[model samples]
Target: MKQIKIGVFGCNRGGDYFRSLLANNADIVAVCDKDDFWLNKAKKRLGDGVAYYASFDEFIEHPMDAVLLANYFNEHAPFAIRCLEKGIHVLSECTAAGTMAECVQLVRAAEKSKAKYMLCENYPFMKFNREIKRICDSGTLGKILYAEGEYNHPVASSDVAFMRKYKPYAEHWRNYLPRTYYITHSMAPIMYATGANPIRVTALPVFAPFDDSMAISGSHCGDRAAIITTLNDDDSVFKVSGCAGFGAHGNSYRVCGTEGQIENLRGMGTQVMLRYNKWSKPAEMESNNLYDPKWNHKDEALIEKEGHGGGDFLVIQEFLNCILEDKKPPFDVYFATRMSAVAILAHRSLLELGMPYDIPDFRKEEDRVKWESDFLTPFYGPNGEAPTLRCSSHADFTPPEGPMKAYLEAIKTRE
Candidate 1:
């Protein structure tokens, strides 16, 4: 098979999956990023003959079979649409689009273009998660009824300030985002574990205190958010939480079914527990906790090394295989768009005081038309995409300027 030439955007995050691409049926042709520091570093570390561009406009014009969209979080949709127009396949990072309207446009673009698109959501590829998928798919955990996923990464005031100030571009999406929008990490795994489509979405925001540093950093967006989603297949429900102000440091998940259930190690190191239900009152369920290498037989390196338990590498490899073999990726554009679209409606539900919103089935043509013109958002981009900083969690709160100044001073000292 011939090697597919690939160009990666956002060198900072781009570097994480480089080895994986290089190891697969692909060639690293170029990398693009405005951050000269990381850009120069990646160019040097990867050696000579590899083109590097500071401008995305010029980078897209480079000859390549595919492009990796690791740019700022909310900018992938527009960039991917342009790439598809250019007839280049796309492998995007997280949360497919910033708004529902963009989601519609993105789906339509991929539908028309010959090039394919895959959202590189890595959490679902984690060793435990993959095992959960296998067990559920095998019907060992028969008829999944409920699931839970959580991602809590609390940061100090200084790091949060620096992130708000000097990170990426001036109007970085993370700086002004609805808490529910960053739901991909916590929610994608459950969706992948079971092939369930979210039919309805409702959310409750975890409000931050007035004195919280995040509130000071122009993020009145809740410190965290809880989303309750009802699935289309069996009407199953999934509870997902993300960005909790202060809580556990990593990701965790749990799946419950009729025959058995499995849960992440969580605070218990690297072990996971598998339990089976019994009707006897004295012995209702059996539990086992240990690491079984057999669970990740498909890719042992992923469980032994690399980032996110080696999931970082596995997801990239899957994308490349799809491109090389002319196969559809595991997480295709439609499924990925649903992930982002559900988050958009979940935020809407929060704004309406936890009221439920029906998640439009984008698979149906009529459903896409209903939301074709619905792309408005509270948080904005350089293009006036949104106009508010606060979602429903906090009222009358504005992102403070004091932290911004402090963040600027800290970066200036470093320079």
Candidate 2:
């Protein structure tokens, strides 16, 4: 196999992506971040040979074959376009574009440059989701009727460390991102499994008292948003309840089809429930025991040992394999963009107060024009007047005290 040279941007959360790249034994030529502290960390972790750059302009000019974008959630599109323009392959993180215009620009850039681009939608690589895709593809699920996939992460209360480290930037635009703004994690799997793209969306903001709890906890964002999306073939709903201050963290999915339905079991087990209309009764299943049964597989064991539900490893592995073999990553750029575009358009729907919005089919050339000249400016600016990203707030805005304060303080001390 030819050696692959790669550079990574956004070294903080992109740390996992970097670590996974190292584990797969690919050559990491450079790593860059806006934060000088993280850029140094990448240098230290990757050793003296790994080049570190604080300027994106200089970083893109580096002699590398591919760029792995772990940058800000909304900023990936512009950077990805720059890399593609330079003939560098791209693997960008979710929320592909901040606005519709960037989406079309990105697609056009990919086509014009003829470079490989993969959208990093790792949720589909989770063992359960992969198995669900397999089962669905087998035609065992029959014609899909209706389904629901949910990502309910209690990051507010649980991720104290995350809140503290990035708190300075948290008050930036990302903190106040719309509730539906981060919908890719939950919706990608359903789209990946069914091989369908969301055609249109009618979004509803789940504004309740929980929003106040997060604001009180110093979160600058909204509580939740639900999207009722119409897919090309199957009608489905995706809900992202990210009231970070409420409850324990859990992620689950349920897919109901014409012949059967599969649901992930609650609690510690990664179980699924399959009910076939053709059969007399329903049955339950576990994803790990079946498809990616052993987390210790040489290629995947390290992933299981390291990150979110063991998906980190698999996703990077696929990225490496594709680059080395000159093939396409399973979750290619177009696929990743499609999944991410849902969140972008859904947020548009929410901002419009549940207005219906059309989702462009990038696979078709004619559809690209609707958004090409458009740009959705983000809420935050260099001048620091962050736009007010609102959702209905019934949550109480009280500064946390007692154990929670002490806990947050302790984490801050460590940072």
Candidate 3:
């Protein structure tokens, strides 16, 4: 296949995956970031010949087949829409749209443009989760009754590097968002492995003191919330805690089917224990070496060495395969919306003091019009476009300024 020329936005996080693509399937023609530090880093790491841009407008003008958006979390939707409108393919990161309104618009944009839109949700590609998906689909677990997924990262206290780097941006609404807003990381795997559609979700925010403290510290917003979701033919419960103030680090999930249960083992990276009522208490178990080989069997050993537990490389590899084969990606726009839409609805439930909410189907074209004009994110103009940061909000909120404060200022100036 001819090499696909691409522009990668958000240099820091974009570096690894962009480099992986360069090493495997594509050419990194251009790179962009608001921060000079990342731009310089990308230059050093990806080589000097690649063009780099500091501004989004300038980056979009570069000739490229696709745009890999590794920009801000809340900003992905508008940027993806713009790229699609310009006839460029887009691969966006997690919680694809910050709000339900943007969710509808994003899907419509993809449908109209006929350009490939893929959600880079790496957790589903993790070896343990991939194995579970294989087994569950193989009919070994029987009908899935319930499952739980979590990305309960204590980001505030765990790592000093990110805390210091993002101190300024962390002070804003994008940083101190509602508790339920982060549900995708902790919830996507179950949805991916089980193929169950969540019909209704009742989300109750945990108003414990830990969350209140984080809010006061200008770190996180409300406390963590528990989502009681009823799937199409099954039921499940998912809870996630992502405060700088509390909880453990990393992502994990558990699946309980009518005949068995599977869980990611604690402490050991990527190990899991499968149990069943039909067999012994510890039905089966595996760790480390045995783990990676399960999923790596499909690709070369070199590709296996590339990503987060083999996931990062797989996501990139799949994106390239879909392009070459003229096929829709497994994690296409419809499923991507399914994985992220609950977070938006869950946030609504928190605002209503944990009222149950039904997630709307964006796949049905009829539902698109109801929310096209609604902009749910704290930022964004009524027309669903990015706005300029005003003088009062122009100051960069790196590490020390905190994310909550930076977030509010962002809404005031740019929203």
In order of listing, the candidates' clash counts read 2, 6, 21
- Residue 232, candidate 1: C-alpha displacement in angstroms: 3.4
Sorting all predicted structures by TM-score, with the top scorer first, yields: 1, 2, 3
Residue pairs with backbone overlap in model 1: 218-399, 380-386
**Which is superior by lDDT, 1 or 3?**
1
lDDT by residue (175-273, candidate 2, tens digit) is 556666666777777777877667777676665333232332444444444544555534554444322223455666777667677766656455565
How do the candidates rank by lDDT, highest first? 1, 2, 3
Give the Cα lDDT of each candidate: 0.76, 0.67, 0.66
Q: Cα RMSDs of all predictions?
A: 3.1, 4.3, 6.2
- Of the candidates shown, which would achieve the greatest lDDT relative to the real structure? 1
Model 3 scores worst on lDDT over the 10 consecutive residues at 389-398
Candidate with best TM-score:
1
TM-score winner between 2 and 3, please give it: 2
Q: Can you write out model 1's per-residue Cα lDDT over 1-415, one digit (the tens) per residue?
A: 8888999998877888787787665788999988788797798878888999998899999999999988877778999999999999999998788778889899999999999899998888777888777767877677889998887766566564456334533345665667777788888888888877788888877766335443324344544555545555567888877445556588888888877788877876545677775541124335553554354356565435667776787888788889878999878889899888877888777776688888877778898999988867666675665554355466765545665555444544323
TM-score of each: 0.90, 0.85, 0.82
